[model samples]
Target: MNRRAFATLDRPYKNKTTLDLLNSLAVMKFSKIKPLVSAFPTLINMNNNAVNCLIKKTLFPVFCGGETIKQTIPTMRKFRESNIKTVLALAIEADVDELERKGTDAVSYTRKMVDDLKVCIDGASKFSDNFMAVKFTALVPPGLLKRWSFNLKKLQDHFELVSTDGLLSRSNVSLVQDAFPNLDASIFDKCDELSFSDITAAVSIFGPNAHQLILNDPLSVDADDIETFQLLLNEIKDICEYAQQKKVNLIMDAEHDYFTPAIDDIIIGLARKYPQGFIYQTYQMYLKTGFERMKRDLLRLEKEGVAMGVKLVRGAYMDHERHYAKMNGLASPINETLKQTNDQYNAAVEYLIANNVPLFIASHNEDSIAKACKLIGPNSNVRFGQLMGMQDSITFKLAQGGYNVYKYVPYGPVPVVMQYLYRRAQENREMMNRLDKDKRYILTELKTRSLFK
Candidate 1:
């Protein structure tokens, strides 16, 4: 693609000043951290107003729709007209209510967002099989996971209590007695048969970490939790169905390692139930085990007779992962070097593109994307994705070259954008450190753009 088309991907603005400032601020914001920044409140307060102003004045025009629904369509339309796909995401994360409420709200928001996107996509026929990206945390609820972890601790305490007390009274250990009746009934036979009130009192008074203990027990899957998950799956299925009917493809993003296993379980289960290529799971090639995991996932999907959709990213959580590992004296999950990450990322892309699974390459690197163009044979199922504000040169040029391309457009309130921008800035800075040449190129590009007539 020529620079003209590359420039049009970031259309609507008459000049490059906003985009230039956005890029410059992004460079500064990621590397700046305060001691009090450990808490979300401080971080939000520090950059919330300024970042929001930057977002509205610069990044939003370049990366997002307006803060509201009506504002997003025009941006989506511009890409659609250029034969590029647009993935709309509503960025909402908070320390609010429990998981069920959050999941419900996320589902509601997704439905609304999809409905809004459909009006433009249907009219223009420019959207792919999915028009939006979904965050699992948005649907699963943070508190549920927290509560689940808490319940595991409680279960461990319950185990300790029963081992010592030996079921002296129903009030003291009846739940265990009921849960494991075969474990020496003689220890409880002589014990008093406590009344319901006594049992409740004992549990309420002694089982302080009841939730945590329950979470520890692998067998402690609550029907309510399962039902809540079922609701999320149903909602996802609804979205997938709508996407399929409308020819949109929804790509599931890769999150932190702590949450990814559950996301994997959900995606695998859904793939088994739905054979279509509507859903995709992400693989960050930088991890040591990502390629193995991807190979296994592909095999599992093939065995289950489902079309696999895969997204390849270089990863966003390396610094946090490495820092935590160092603090705790544990081995890190991140690739030891950027070269390793690049190698793995490109290999995974080759695997998926070669395998004929519907694939999306989400990266900022030119070499890896060029590898994709070479590997994507005739009739290949692939799309390249890049963030709306970052890496314009690649996305626009790829779109111009006639390869499938999509812009990841994030939209929402100012506070949320602050969080997102912080992460983006951090990731870009890390990438700069890892790939020094790329940073030099960015400097050169900024200079060239400044001088461009």
Candidate 2:
């Protein structure tokens, strides 16, 4: 690939103010401190005025947009001035216990979340360069999501065991039942009514065709779980419907694997209904099977004429996922190495570019972004996204090159987004180190100008 375009990495920061560079350096420098990073979340949450003020001045400005849409405007305007767009997302998500504690009040909590998201969508509607992002974890109970995922995986496993080598037709229902003698009646009916012989390649690529049934709207969750699942689905549908009316685009943010399968199924279900390009799904490439999932979904969406968008990322939950798997004695799903991840990421990028699908390349890696640009050339269908505070150079360089660039801006109260900011701090250290040479170049330029003084 011709890598000449973004070779001069120094060019990325040419337009950044000296203060911007210094602030970025501070974010990395602070993150590198083991103790401070460790204490950050607890300290921020305690309402300690000094700690809050210091973090608000430092990491808050560098990592998050602001506490609310009104507060987020200045940051959004600054990005707009630089020819970059903003993917605005709220900073709250619910845990399993939180929902169970709420019980029927879960409905009230979801309604409140829906309102908050609509506010974000309205905010995005006001700015042509800004779009909104929402997480399913924030919309419903995480426990419920796990319930749906567990059942889906069980169905997928059963289908895989009985699935034949050749084309799978409705007649294959016998095979599935023969393998799973006491399969649920609902699943059998769902299975008996569906066939994957036509969408062969796409279905086969992703293993069993059971989950594909979710796309067909024949979801098979536990009898007790169905009611709550429908409520969550309806909540998402309401938020998405509002976004569509406003002509605002929505990207569904991906969480950890526990909720991802259900998230993916819900997104495909939404896409089947509103394929007008309003809903985009995220793919985390660090997962070993991430690329195949994206490829399979893309093929199916294409064949079914469902309009959907994709956001590609290397993933964020490596440490947590691995730790959880080890504790539970389950195999880790994350790719074992960075190179494995990068290879999968790049392949997904190339595949999207080759197919001319609308994609958001959400990364700070210079090489990956440059490779995507090479494949994209002058294509406007592909957009490049980086976080708000990190990777200033790469973001600006893409904007300077006249590519579609976006900054993923998280907006919420500092205490509320403490977890997000902390995660950003941890993730930023490695990437910032890689950009040290660029940092020195920016510093040298600063010393040469009185504007910096």
Question: Taking the tens digit of each residue's C-alpha lDDT, what string does model 2 give over 53-99?
Answer: 77789989888888888989888888888788889889887655553
RMSD after CA superposition, every candidate: 11.0, 4.9
lDDT of 1 by residue, 1-453 (tens): 322322233222212354553454454343444332334345566665664575566444545665755677677776677666777776654332433454456557545655654453353244444356766665565444434433433433455566443223545564655553323333334447532222222322122322222332443434355445555555656656666677766667776654554466566656666677777888888778789768866775685477868888988777767886788797898888889999999888877777788888899887788767776765668888888766655665676667778888777666666666656655555555333443344455555666432
Q: Top model by TM-score, which number?
A: 2
What's model 2's overall lDDT? 0.74
Q: Lowest-scoring 10 consecutive residues by lDDT in candidate 1?
A: 204-213
TM-score per prediction, in order, is: 0.68, 0.87
The local lDDT score (0 to 100) that residue 224 gets in candidate 1 is 52
lDDT, candidates in the order shown: 0.59, 0.74
Q: Where is model 1 more than 4 Å wrong at Cα? A: 1-43, 46-51, 93-130, 143-224, 326-330, 433-453
Q: How many backbone clashes does candidate 2 have?
A: 0
